[model samples]
Target: MAVRSTHSPSKIPTIYQCDSKGRENQTIAADMHGTLLIDRSLFPYFALIAFDVGGILRLLLLLLTAPLAWFLHHFVSESAGIRVLVFASFAGVKVSEIESAANAVLPKHYSEDLHPETWRVLSSCGRKCVLTESPRIMVEPFLKNYLGVDLVLGTEISSWWGVATGFMARGGVLVGEQKAMALRKAFESSLAPEIGIGDSEADFAFMNLCKEKYIVPSEQRVRPVKQVELPKPVIFHDGRLVQKPSPLIALLIIVWFPIGVLLSVSRVLIGSNSPISLFYYIIQLTGCKILVKGTPPPNAKNSRRTGVAFICSHKTVMDPLFVSAVLGRNTTCISYSVSRLTEFLSPIRNCRLTRERSKDAKIIKDILEEGWDLVMCPEGTTCREPYLLRFSSLFAELTDEIVPVAINIRTSMFHGSTARGRKWLDIFFFFMNPLPVYEITFLDKLSPDQTCSAGKSSFDVANNVQEMIGTVLKFKCTKFTRKDKYRMLAGTDGLVGGKPGAVAADKLS
Candidate 1:
């Protein structure tokens, strides 16, 4: 594969290849100005915050403070012509309420998604604030405590004698141009040269107000903003989606299928102890493969005793079965579906064939209590890139340790994941032709830590795990931002289709 560099005057490089650190620099350069662009001193001191209040309960209280402040300012400022004092008192009270809410929402895992650089910049800056539409009540705690921001200017809601009153400024809306204006007004006299970071185009409106406008790159590509054309989104292809398979690959899958069956038979007939042998067998049979990159956790030597969630990269449908063979009876796999055609009750009967509204919590709870090593693909489904999907937070509750696993299926046999519009017949035809060896790569395991509060939302835990995994994997497999999906459909023009060397480079990178 040839690497394309240096765009000529006639043609622009449609895409850019950069890792996380490079992406960060790109965002800052595109949005910021002044000598501080290259200044290392400000890098650590740039505080970052978001728009949300974090959770349901706190969001409610934050919503309440809007009207509460509005009423006070409405009366006091009108009566005394000293509105700053009224707003200041209201801001303080609202800030305290936010602190209380943060305490209530205590024990959240640190997330790289939802404003990670913001936190990094804030922690580095030593001072930060949350600029959200959430009332000052919700924004204050995070701004003052977690982010350590000096100020929070947000909407206010009202409460009457502890119960919220339904009155607020313009009925409590602080979004769009208003949010941008509010932020600009607060920082008007600052000489420190502040840098602002945001995730969306909406954020660009406000971000432009700052000395710099830092736009977070989506999973696939950066997009064209109002005036600035951001970098193209990054496309992460799963190893399983290759187009043609080599001859040796065909032989491997054929040999592995029966071996898996034999292991399953022996486990039942001869009382053999190892179930993972069968799992390996099944994966090989399913036309997929596993590449164990690191040492299996000593604690996970027997998954039955440990609450292990085999958090594998999602690609093909064969993943759950492949992992099941490896784990054997020591674990139970949870999937979105199962075959109605197959009978014979195994411990695998616990599988849910569909995602229903009510069953999720119950299923996750039972699996944890049984001390079973639950196998889950955080992506929930296969996409063009396995790395971009948001991981499920269920692992945070089930186990403290997450075994980071990566799988690369040679897609040469298949057109691509239906996620990219390849049909079932297309996949089957590819299998009928030549096949490629499936490569499963397992990375390091994260030791379980109870750093996040148990009471926090599962999504929060998943977000934390995604970040941790992203840093370790370094291939950007964490959150699938909206931009990521859009880029996959767009495809890379002039790029070779299914070139082995080119695909391999993508995997390693």
Candidate 2:
């Protein structure tokens, strides 16, 4: 007869039986899902528990050593495969999770430093490819999705049992000579790249295979080299302006409300022009360096030195103030719009006008006839990039003695454009910097005939002047208008619903 053990149903073991000696024993086994199923056997139970504990300890060790491995790979070995391995060791089921997180933010960081001109060229190229030594797992998505590259070549990382084992693919490393070999094998067809561009010496081997080679200097290893040549009338200096101010300068600006008011009152009482000079002094106190290129032309015979009709590239609100300071004369500015506080606080006279061509022309002509020197930004808005938008020619029709001026503003900490904020905020941020430099170049005097002809309208005059200024300053000429910019920033075309009729007239001309 067979011996059987009786026990409560809840106490039954999944794997337990009585041996020939009638002694109860148990064994270890696995379920269909590969989960370890153990009976009440002491030795096997302890062994399985120890194995799990060892796995946990090994995972913890990898987590602790990850940073050390990354540091060694970056500083000592400089090996791309080692870097990949370091990242791979930490990756388990989280590879997709890591990729999803990187996808959300990495494109923005990559594009911050990418030049617009570079992007234009790359997008226009029919067959574009990215060759990098970084692991394909990291770079491919960005190159393919964001940049729309046709092909990508990068280091390969291996995975095992649904987890990365910190091992590189069979090839030793994808760099230097290896990169060159890979490029040759991949592009075996007769058609090859017409031009090749690279940043470091490591890229030279493969770049040499192309018909033309251009090397982009690495920021870490190479000094920036400026290639564009500005015209004779233009002067270019690259430096930071907004910086920590000296104690004395800072104190003066802080106490400027009292001092400035006193200076204004004294100038008024004495009938002196010292107030204008003092205003300029305050601006210069901010460590701003102003460069003036051309001289003011002599007056015509009958003209009572009719104030110069200054047409400038709009950069910041301080433009009129700085130009007046540079010229050592009070200038009346014509603006489309201005804040109530700014208009009230401004020392110089500001004339506001509407977009209606006839109305604006009448106001501008009256101001000129009054012998008040007029300063205007023909672009109708401020642009921070090294580019110029289409100019409004209404000012061109008002005066023949138009002085084309190019203004370049450089700041280390803040950009002096109103695109990101309001005018007052732009000024606040600008002055907050330690130093801000302003470069104002007065180009040749532009006459109506020089810019306008029988078939050509005042718009021609505006474009001619724009070309002269852009050429001198090495700025790209663009068709973008203030309306387009406003639409981009504020999500509306203008104060009105659509583009202004004045801008439409300018475009037609």
Candidate 3:
């Protein structure tokens, strides 16, 4: 018999909902929020704190129960049951209230740690299942109502109508070997999992049964163990984004900030003509390597060539600086948007273009006509993924002397992405890192026929150049645009307060 909660339909928890023929239901069985989503045991910790017992009594209860809880958690194979019983004894709280509080707070707490890449994979899968040792009441609302996981299987805490009974149901602890058996029973015809991802040894019982198994490593492990090599990089550590700084590194960054600023100003003042080399020198002092591949074209040496346009793949605000330093050229960079402070402090001559296509075209054409080598990122924004955003074809129509420059940025401590509201911070973090490498390569030039022809539009030219750069850097090409990035970062549709005019004015200034 399936037990149903009296809570609203939206908050109703699904314990074991399966059709008669389980063979037809194929799901990607992921672990719960704390395991697969974030690195936090929210239910247990929050329940202890929010228990109805007085603060001192609660503290005393925890102190008294901790040893027994630890013993039960380790000694017993079905430890989750004992842990739940211990929690229920002193909790003095209704399961409904705890469930309500969990539903209210879980989203806000773990929203940032909700791995976008994981969601991207799961969402593409037709159905996904969550199997966890956490209490079903605690994790159900978030996983079902918010994350939309199709199936959830977790430890069941016995209750009397609407009250806690301080005991787990018989054979209810869904953990370890029991978890493996439950998974097997859920599916008929001896169906096997195609892929399994888990963090701890407890999951090994069922994870080992899969064709492909991935273990997320943690310091809690007894010793260093071999992990399955994944196809792509995973950017998570202990359930949080990978950006924690050690105390010594933090202090070093604080001390290095002023020195970096001084060096930057000195370069701007004394090395303006060859600022690229000076910038390269400054970055090298921070233990970064700048590798430039492929020589510039002979015509690239002629600074007076009107049609010369340096088309670069955007990775960070520092892209143009690296390109200029590598080529030893004074170039004017065109950008759609830039922080006002960054614009003021930048060493290169930068032109902020408006969204007005006609005006931007006129400005770009005039700049090219003035015999100034133009440097522009056709993608218009920085993306941290090794993927190229769709390119703008405006520059392709303006000039045919397009030199596609591939820029690859690597940092040991900080990400070099200059997303919205992080331009100055990105630069600060870029310099703070002990070693940040920037690899620049110049691809073959794009001729007029390749870029813009009667049959092929400027878009074809842009795509062709984008493909060449992606091939060289081994980056994936994505359809996401700068507008998509802005909407994501700023929460507006690439405009502030629905006013593009004000935004354009701010960017121009």
| Full-model lDDT for every candidate | 0.41, 0.52, 0.59
Q: Pick the candidate with the highest lDDT.
A: 3
lDDT tens string, model 2, 1-509?
Answer: 11122233333222112111311221110110000101111111111111122222333343344456457655765464245433433344344532432332223223323433233334445566666555565545545554556677666666776455455676645666566666667677645454444544555566556544444432332211122311011011111112222223323334443444354344332322346656656556445566778885543323665556888988877688777777776778889877675666567788899889899889888887777878899888876656778888887676777888888877654445544334554454455444567788888786445744434578778888888888888887766677665543332322355534222212222
lDDT by residue (tens digit), candidate 1, 384-448:
43354666565665555567666545544333344322233223322332433545555566533
| Segments of candidate 2 deviating more than 4 angstroms | 1-274, 297-306, 451-456, 487-509
Clashes of 2: 10
TM-scores, all candidates, are: 0.38, 0.49, 0.56
Cα displacement (Å) at residue 268, model 2: 20
Clashing pairs for predicted structure model 2, backbone only: 241-435, 241-436, 242-433, 242-434, 242-435, 242-436, 243-433, 243-434, 243-435, 244-434
Off by over 4 Å in 1: 1-231, 234-276, 279-289, 297-306, 328-330, 337-350, 353-358, 420-435, 450-457, 471-473, 481-509
In model 3, pairs of residues that clash are 39-239, 276-325
**Candidate 3 per-residue lDDT over residues 147-260, each given as its tens digit:** 667777787776676665656666667777767776666654545665455656677676655544554444342221112122212111110112322223334434555675
Output the lDDT of residue 432, model 2. 46
